[model samples]
Target: MHNATVIALRTVATILILATFVPLLPFEAWYIRIFDFPRSQIFVLAAFTLLIFLVLRWWRYGIDKILIPGLVASLVFEAVNIYPYTFLSPVQVQQAPADAPADGQLSILVSNVYQHNVEHQLLIDLIQEHSPDILLTLETDSIWQKGLRPATDSFPERVAIPLSNTYGMHLYSKLPLRQTRTRYLLEEEVPSIKTYVQLRNGVWVELHAVHPKPPVPTEDDDSKTRDAEIVLVGKEVKGSDYPVIVAGDFNDVAWSHTTTLFQKVSGLLDPRIGRGFYNTFNAKYKLLRWPLDHVFHSDHFKLVKMERLPHINSDHFPILAILSFAPENKYEQEEPQPDEDTAEEAAETIEEGKEEAQEEDD
Candidate 1:
């Protein structure tokens, strides 16, 4: 009976580990996304991480029913998190840059402004204070766009993809809106903007702004489609010589395999390491929180500072990153681990999606 109990506990641990991958999946088939799931990602993730502690106790007794599997699962899971710890408080932006160009370093702001949120003035106040060079807003319907029109005048260049549904997205830029193209990364009309921001230095780097649908029960939450779409974007950037910046409401935490794969596949650098984890979602609940929004870049830039802005009547808090243009060694490489086996699995999944999409078309 005792041995059975141990095995049962290990199985539970395994299920929790499975939750780590939930954010990577889509919302259509599975009911795992926050909107449809039984609980928040924070709760499931914490429980799974705790399970590691519980199963680790077997080492003391020399009993190992599910210990090995649980440990392996947890290790792989944590290895992929962008940053799981919340100890990261805000850091002040650098006062000045040596030989700073006249145009100054470019700054990007990402916010998942809830559709129902009415605090348009509050958001305006925050925007005026931060003044990002480029801004990406999610869940912005036509109403929200109208409310934001006043602010849009300040940044003449813009890309607007508004929807009455909660998935609408938009981008406004103070920099030259060079070569902007909107792609339906995961789903139709759920747009992701790929553009170039002409820097003050006369140099330009590619930018990919994405707001993948969270895996949920009622919504399109099967993250398989979402994950593949985002991964394909990373694949698009795999061989590009242009520095890349991919940011926005990923719905996945910093510590998930999907996000890590996005980072690895895109050759992007995460500054959170030796830094901090800035949890941006679930402003309603303190205990249940993780970094759902993110900003990742290529190593060509130096980390100047990153900050979390005040709540502006949205479910998500605004995350702003102030980065500088510094020449970096492109050769400082991270070995790609798109393991052959994993690629084959992902390929199979993609083929399945194509089949499903075709059937739906039929």
Candidate 2:
């Protein structure tokens, strides 16, 4: 009975360890893609398994020795992936000086208001309390737009694309908007908003709001479309001289390969790096939570404040960030740069998207 128990535990441990590799596969099947969302859970499971095996003296010679080490390795691997997002890691985006002029500051609030959710007042209250300079909401249909209308009246510049398919987006800003464009990037259903906002200091900062479809059995069979959309945006911002801020519910994890590539190609910096995952999704399930909503900015700005706001009856908790434009400190933070191989991969992703578009046209 004792040996049998050990064998069962060992088997379960092996499965947990191997599950981590599913996300590493180049394929984009929903099952494979989902494995990328639970690195923290995997780490916990691996650690528990390792502890149990150690207590059972499973490392006392035989194949148990090999299995024990394997478990250790698996635990270590997950830890490494999550370490960068923790406070222990070096800060990726430097904090703004306490005395930084208010004229150079900008606060943004991003929320993925689940379309079916009807708690509009909660969201409205949250927004009123924070009163960010810019607000972007995702999954907003006509109902959400109507519900939010009263609160948004205060925002002088607004971009509302109301849709029923859960891909709806809205941008409300108090700052003056110049040269704003609403685009249906790859999929006609998935829309993105790009605009230049004149900051308080009279400096214009480029902002892009996107909410890509997730790799799921129902929404999208693979991540191709989502990856392509992000890559194309990265390509657009690659050589731009303007200070940029990209915000949205990316539906992708912070540690995923595609997000890393996007950051590198676009030269944007994720403030979450070394600042904790700030997991925003699966608000009801603690174990299933991961950072899906993000705010990536150019190195020309420094972090003023970042917080995961209280849940407003949505699956995602809104994220708010305040950034101070400091061109002089641009070089203080290291920007992500794509290597030759990564650049080629980004190009290929963009090309694949164009080809998909051509096929649709044909």
Candidate 3:
């Protein structure tokens, strides 16, 4: 409805007002976790819908030099990861050796390899060149799994759960994988691998490998369910005995509020802040980029080196990080957010959710 300039102005104003709520503490960004869909799906759709509606109205309103540019700038600011948010999060570091350390720190390679991508040799070459202690592969099917038999042979131990579905995952480790289990974070077969690894200095670190469902509109359309699964894991690891390390294709960006809460709740740190946002997805796009992959750790680990490996056949470039032990002077007393239960609000939200679920199930 390209009606009048005044109507367009009113529409733009409404969109900006809505965007403001995107970053509020718990209700806007984190509340999606309470739903059954993937968190990113909810986030991306909501963002695009709002953006498109605003842009169309602004065009119709016709204050070209002022309102339209302002709207574009605002969208860039909202989505782009600029300075201040640079690096990523507490991924900040204090010091490091100029040359490679005499003693090697544990290096972890987390790659989604894209189930349909057939450049297995390229991946193998990269793995051989890097020789990381652990490797995590997502979206691996029987065909992909069959291709990596040789690589798995090199590692003494591995856990493979290959499915034709894209949710299939596998992990190969050089060290003894003690009590490792393949866990589903939600109803989908998105598998997260958790196990303990003995580092060179005799310290043990708990590692969790994850591949949350992407937020795009497919079978799983909601982002709340996926986010809830991640939040649930963060809740589980609070006050855990060993240091923790989590890696995988989170399907969300580094700067989202949910990610920040995850870091706070688990007492983990991102290795990208002040370092770089090694955007791993859309390797083909020259400009449009998002850091959808991640490596997060508890306070005990000090980031040694982190980088985005060269692109293979997948839409995602691999991410690798080497971390060493850095014991804390005192553990964080911080409590995780999004745990509110005001009866009035919860009653309404819960009732609404039950009604929706019943409608779908029926």
lDDT for model 2 comes to 0.89
Name the top TM-score candidate: 2
- What's each prediction's TM-score? 0.76, 0.96, 0.74
Highest lDDT model number = 2
Better of 2 and 3 by TM-score: 2
Q: Cα RMSDs of all predictions?
A: 5.6, 1.7, 6.7
| Candidate 1 TM-score over all chains jointly | 0.76
Taken over the whole model, the C-alpha lDDT of each candidate is 0.69, 0.89, 0.66
* Model 2 alpha-carbon drift over 4 Å, by segment: 1-4, 61-63, 354-362
Model 2, residue pairs in steric clash: none
lDDT of 3 by residue, 102-143 (tens): 343678898888998999988888888898889888898889
Q: After superposition, how far is residue 317 of candidate 2 from its true place, in Å?
A: 0.4
The residue ranges of model 1 lying beyond 4 angstroms of the native Cα positions read: 1-104, 328-346, 359-362
lDDT winner between 1 and 2, please give it: 2
Off by over 4 Å in 3: 1-81, 85-91, 98-104, 328-362
Candidate 2 lDDT over residue span 1-362, tens digit each: 48798678878877886787767777767788888889999899888888887876768867778778888887888888899899999989998999999999999999999999999999999889999999999999999999987789899999999999999999999999999999999888789999999899999999999998998988877787788888788878877779999999889998888898999899999998888999999998888999999999999899999999999999999999999999997998999877879978998887876676556557
Query: What's the C-alpha lDDT at position 296 in model 3?
Result: 80
